[model samples]
Target: MKRLFLVLIPLALLAGCLEVDQHPHWVKGQYAGKKDDLPFQTHFHRDRLSWWGTISNRNQHQNEYNRANP
Candidate 1:
């Protein structure tokens, strides 16, 4: 049981390290196993933020048009 626990624990930690919470483009361009991948990290969060901003702008523009016509 002790041996099994040791092996499983290491495997779980390895799996955690493999997982990254960022876009592939960001990971490849910015991170990519470089030592300076921390401070310059821009990934899925940035992508999502930009997307949300675009959507909000579009919605605001649509509302303005509707108000002007109505």
Candidate 2:
């Protein structure tokens, strides 16, 4: 049992090192879509009065450009 574990342990460690030099498919640009484009995009519309008010208030808080300029 001890001899078997010693041989198996080195083989397992060496197997992990073999993958160190290989790059993943995604990093090599194997997936579709433009490189600069977001993976997902969402389009939202405010159809309700409450939603409109909430989104509007959130946008105001997030509007750094106006706050910075003012």
Candidate 3:
């Protein structure tokens, strides 16, 4: 049992060291990961004014005086 453990433990430790690196491959000046879509594009259907209005309302609600007065 001791001999089995000694052989298997070294083999298990070496298994991890032998793996190939998983760095992303880049295509000349091209992004290789997730595309960053604008929040307004997805959530507000690209209506710039509506997105700004929603942001303004959110910020106003976060103010302590606004909450107290309203």
Q: Name the regions of candidate 2 deviating beyond 4 angstroms.
A: 20-70
Clashes of each: 0, 0, 0
Candidate 2 yields a Cα-based lDDT of 0.64
TM-score of each prediction: 0.28, 0.28, 0.57
Give lDDT tens digits, candidate 2, residues 11-51. 98888675655543464657544555322222234246666
Off by over 4 Å in 1: 24-70
lDDT of model 3 at residue 44? 92
Candidate 3 lDDT by residue in tens digits, 1-70: 9999999998998888978988777789776888788999999998989999999999999999978955
Please give, for residues 12-45, the per-residue lDDT of candidate 1 as tens digits.
8888787667754456457565454432134334
CA lDDT, every model vs. true structure: 0.66, 0.64, 0.89
The root-mean-square deviation over C-alpha atoms between each candidate and the true structure, in angstroms, is 12.1, 9.3, 3.7
Candidate 3: 10-residue stretch with minimal lDDT: 23-32
Candidate 3 clash total? 0
TM-score of model 2 relative to the true fold? Answer: 0.28
lDDT score at residue 52, model 3, on the 0-100 scale: 97
